[model samples]
Target chain A: MSEHHEKPEISPAARRFIIALCVLAAVLVALEFIIHRHAYFTTEGQPLFFAVYGFIAFIVVVAGGVGLRKLVMRDIDYYDQGERDE
Target chain B: MSSLVTLLQIPGLLLVFGAAVVPFLPHKLRQAYMLAIIALSAYWCWGIDVGTHLSTNLAGLDLTLVRAEAITRPFALVFHIAAALNVIYAMHEKSRLTATSGLAYAGAAIAALFAGDFITLFIYWELTAFTSVFLILVSGTPRSFAAAMRYLLMQVSSGVILLAGAVLLWHGGQGLSIQAMQANTLAGGLVLLAFGIKAAFPFLNGWLQDAYPEASVTGTVMLSAFTTKLAIYMLALCFAGTEILIYIGAVMTLFPVFFAVIENDLRRVLAFSLNNQLGFMVVGVGIGTELALNGTVAHAFAHIIYKALLFMSMGAVLYRTGTAKASELGGLWKKMPLTMIFCIIGAVSISSFPLFSGFVTKSLTIGSVAKDGYFVIWMILIFASAGVLEHSGIKIPYFAFFGHDRKFEVKEAPLNMLIAMGIAAGLCIVIGVAPHLLYGLLPYDVKYDVWEAGHVLGEMQLLIFAILAFVFLMVRGWYPPEIDSTVLNTDWFLRRALPRTVNALSRPFLAAWASAVAQSKTAILAVLHTGEETSRKSGLVSGVASTGAAAAIFLAIFALLLLLRFVA
Candidate 1:
């Protein structure tokens, strides 16, 4: 399946748009320092706490999911192989 | 709203009995009848006054069939609306069993919400499990049939545990009341466990992921709305502020995001995301503050709409393309642009984008968590919110619509599906923009504002950064590709490990039992033979004794005794 279709390459324009969006997001994170952020915890008062937290949390979740897939993923027929339909 | 109907006219019954009449109707009228039932029920939900409606004695206990309170009213409202929308969405479906059972399941869920006593709640609770199983089974595939069995068992087990808890509560002199309980007693803990199972708390959650995706497309949409939300309503009613729920809710919020990320099945991803969304409501229920409870109810209301929207879109995709696995789906936006748009709306709503329904509702819970000063939980919840963005926000839309082009052109979703999704998507936006439409329906007085600058900025930062992370991973090819594989969860115990263990355990046990039966059979035969021989010998002896020989012997002995006496 992978060999049948070439992976679609990101258009340069789309790439530029993505980069711009990332920069805009970075600017928002930077603006958080000046914004009067209501920090629930004292530690959360730091600049870009949510940005860093969101980034790391997503990575952790994705990484954790990858690890879990390695442990638990099986052939699609894993549960369906038997005729236990009584 | 209150002047239109008397208390005795329970809205839920209109749905329940109306569903009974569905199978009798001609195929053309079935859809219309279902729609009418939902409409009438919705009208009743709005009209019924906020008080106990019907009280009756059953088996020496009082059961209340309809009780409307501030909390129950909102849940009932959303349930009816969701049912109605689901009916409309499923209008094209011709399956009588699916239509009938779906309506019945919806009605049972509504009735369970209105139930003022544990007995009534229990009746409706188990009814939901029984009726909804038909929806799964009506798919008529062996996989769905098997999934339905597991789904039914898990659901019924929850109901049974609920009954046991109710009985214990009654024995403890609680008198069958359905109300908040302390977890110090056996009844309270059992009741919590029961609700937890339906609510898909952590390890007990596998059933939702296992069975829901396997349901028929329309059935999945109907299912996505009710069962768990019903349990959430029950939890809000019965186990508010139980403390342990706080931790459970936190864990519930976090774990599903991970599973959802790598999930190949789009519907299963939605299932995991559903679990994650329920976590927010659970946290609110755990907080048990008036604000938190209101948040929970309002969130459930919003979630039903948005989640159904998501499921309906995916259902459309599955209906058209014949597969919901992400591995087999991509670049569908070219043909199914309407569905893509709706899916994006759902994704945005669930992601808590600033102008979406989830923003208005989920923020309340996060705010309450922060206000209550549980810093760690508050942090975990924030993280989970971002995780929500990863799996539901990006993964759902990107893989299905915008990811690598699968070069498949399919027709747009059917008109009924688009209309249903349109209405749901409309509600998501309406509630997001004008939140008071939802806030006013909350169980408590509404004071919190969702558009506070700090909250808006913080949520935006979190969501945007999460998106950035996703883009980073995608561009770098670090993101996991969707595969045609099954990811294991707690269901492994019942579906895989337990079956194998049973097979392994039963073999030796069967052999030993066979040997034991053989030994017992030999011993029993020997005993029977001995008895037969002894009986034959005894029969001959008795036959001789009964005859003249015995009489002569007796006479001789008597004569001897008489002679001896005479001599003496």
Candidate 2:
């Protein structure tokens, strides 16, 4: 069905990035287990937390905006030819 | 305003009657008539009293035209908005019956929220069921007809259960004063069960997925707002703190995500996600604290916008492209940029992105659960939230808007369609950006700040991480994308597997019955033919033999009866 569409190739850099993410996730999970085992994390007020929150929010908004513009869009009638009830 | 509340009582019916006349009118007048009904209904909504009684009965049932209280206000406000917006969205459709039904459905739902008595609620409650069915029928497809029947049956059954409960409560001399449901009694259970059916509680969930997808694009938009939310509203008001709802809510949240993951129809996926979101409000209602109740009400308020926005986006797609199957769709964002943007906002909001509408409203429920120290429920809720992101967040957008861009061309959504979405999308953001606008309307004061550093960071971390997981799975081809195929969940018990099983189990029985019917017909025909042949061949002989036998039997019976009577 997608004969005219070329399959995009995956890059090594993207693969490396994914591997790094996996490693970071593992470290985070390990940290969570350790902290829970010792019960080290507490809901205490911290300025650094707020800063990080704001920063991440900024990053996400920008990233999501760009991604929507670049990757996620379509013509209104793009799939008009597909199955539809008259 | 108290006097004005009475207008809400009957205006919906009046508007419906007025809308019924639209078809006979000139083409230009149809939209005007529909718009007038909506305008009048909105005017009536503004006049209805909140937190006060409008009418009461000798049986001590307090019938209020409006309860501007924190709990009911959000529902009424959102419903009014949705009704008006649906009118706008549906303006271009030629079906006058649909407009009339929409008016009646919205009016009934709006009145139901204001009902201080079970009787009044029951009246409007059934109105919602009866009138809303027109929407599906207006679709004019065989599938929609069947779906509408199922939807009507389910909704009518809910009304029956609710009415039965009301009757029991009234007769038992309790004097119906709408309050929380009790666990030990038949009446309370029936009422709770009624709400459960409408609320799409785990097992009773199939009707929504079955029906909503089959509705007209605009019909589904209206469908998204009222029925389930009203159930939640009832649950919040009447069954608050029923501990079972906590577990039920947990299950409701977690289970649908998996089905949503593999589901092909974007609308059905949204329907599942809707069920998941309702679970949060259910949990809050079960918690039954001021904060929790506030959470439930607030969540309902926020959810209406975002969910409608989501539906609006998909509806636009379906309206223009005519199919909502994820696999069959790709890359229409170029033509429908506004729709894409709006849908993404809806997605982020549903995913509870920090600073989005869902973030503020949903956290209250999550926070309340955490505060209550129900660690397991909270954990399940978080899991469900992640699952929500997976199905609705990545799946809906990735397939419908972005995926492979199948290179088909269609015009952007109609101007009215864009306007409808634009309004709903704006609300999603506005409510998120300034939650106090919504939070202030909560039944109880919520002291917790949604934008607090901890809450914001925690939610951001969770949602962002979930998105990362989705992207990772997708990029690695680990994400399941069985688009254009249904991935049944508990609905399987009804929609496919149960129906299939029933059909399978009945095949032999039906065949046997059919064969028996055929055999009986043959035997009767054979007997008739034989009798005709006998009459033709031996009519005199047969009559003489019959007469002789009849005379002999009459003589024997007469002799026995006469002997018995004489002996007595």
Candidate 3:
């Protein structure tokens, strides 16, 4: 079975939601500089460290999942194959 | 929290036997009765005070029937709370077997929390397994049957290992008490391995993902609360400061996030999320500070509630729509708005949003890690935090409620389910808003300010940006589409490779056995041939008078043999 290639429908409400998310992200990014962040490690003190790390980590995790599917995903009945259904 | 060591009989064990009669009661009466039993048990746990030795000698071994650590009180209290909640959550179900077993399972776990010695612990260890397997079996599907067997095997294996560890402790001249021990020792390692399997440490976690999702909806809700948390409680007691667990836990937190992202079953996604949540607790155990231990206990308490809420919401979805696969579920928010809200609350709580249970409780563990200066681990945990948002915090709600609307025409979840979720959601908020309620129950004082400006801002930034990435992926069609497929985990070892390997290895022996059977068949056939051939030697039976000739031949051979013997 092929992966569903259906693109999500973005309505006016969804667009507004995305815009709000973007604004929230922008505000958080702005606050990273304004908020005197306590840094345990030296690199943690860098500008926009958390935002960059979080955004990239989320992408990596999702993208990594795509690659993982190729290696591990089996037919839904993989475990049931050849066994009589109880 | 009490360091009370007394051999007084605790009353939690009675709930197990009390459940035996649960099946006989009328449904409404049974619910009320079990709740009363649980309330009574909670009262028992609340009444016990600390610091006296009271172990009875059984067969020359001091069996500690009653024990309490500083951490024990909260665990015992929450377990009773969960027992009561389970009764309410399953109130609408008619299956007497589920109620009876679920209540018994909770009882066994609570009893275990008070066990001062390893022997007592082992009994309850297997008791929890034996009771909980019924929940999985109640699902009544072939898939669930197979999963139940595997789940039982892993669980029983853990108990057997616990027993063996206890025996080893005795042989080494150490008493069979459940005290902190060095993991490098054989007995300690065996005990830790036992706890690790139940704790769902990395590779051993397959059963959690395999079985929990396969349970009956109410069964899943009940199953979510007890078994694994019991394991975590044991791990914290036995293996705090064990360095390997820190690394094991970090991998545990990281790997599941990726699997959860591609997992199509919403319930299975939550199971994976449970594994990840356990990792934070595990890291706290490994850190072994007062703060870390407190974190572990607090996290378990909050985790049980929110995790059960998450499972219950999905349970509602499964009950109403008859499916939990994300590929088939969407737009449920339209029909089940309240359930959707509860699910989102669960999602946000698990995601550690600043004003939820996970935020306050989970911070202690992360703070402990940061304070301990395990930089790489701290980083992995942070990344995994974002990953939590990806799967649980976002994917569960987004796919089940808001994603490409599947237009399910189902009604809202049952009244009982909503009530269960509402109470749990309220607890999450109460604990989050006034952290001290839970803090006061901790084994040690919670000095970490969860509401600190810096910590809250950083957590918000992490979550907010992760949301941005999700939006980015969705707009670009870059997100992996949910497809219903078997996502392989360590269980593949038992279900596939182990069986296949055994069959392959037995081929030569099977062939030898078949050949030996064929050789034996030939020998038997040869012996039968002589008896069947009466006229093989024509001279013996000879000419015309066949019956007389045969009789004369037999007499002549007998006479000749007698003569030959006489001559010899």
| Clash count per candidate | 0, 18, 3
CA-only RMSD, every prediction: 5.1, 8.5, 3.6
Order of models, best DockQ first: 3, 1, 2
Best by TM-score: 3
TM-score of each: 0.89, 0.79, 0.94
Predictions ranked by lDDT, top down? Answer: 3, 1, 2
Model 3 clash tally, residue pairs? 3
Tens digits of per-residue lDDT for model 1, B94-179 = 78898889998998898888889888888889999998999889889988998999999999999999999999999989888787
Worst 10 residues of 2 chain B by lDDT: B479-488
**Regions of model 1 farther than 4 Å from truth:** A1-8, A82-86, B1-8, B504-508, B517-568
Q: Which structure among the candidates has the greatest DockQ? A: 3
A31: Cα error in model 2, Å:
15
Residue A67 deviation, candidate 3, in Å? 0.9
Off by over 4 Å in 3: A1-7, A82-86, B1-9, B52-54, B534-568
The better-scoring model by DockQ among 1 and 2 is 1
lDDT of 2 by residue, B144-238 (tens): 88779988888989989988998898788775667765855888888898999999999899888888888888888888999999999999888
For residues A1-86, what per-residue lDDT tens digits would candidate 2 score against the true structure?
A: 22323434456754676677666544544443233221112321332332233233333332333343333233333223222411
Candidate 2 RMSD computed on C-alpha atoms after optimal superposition onto the true structure:
8.5
DockQ, candidate 3, vs. native dimer: 0.61
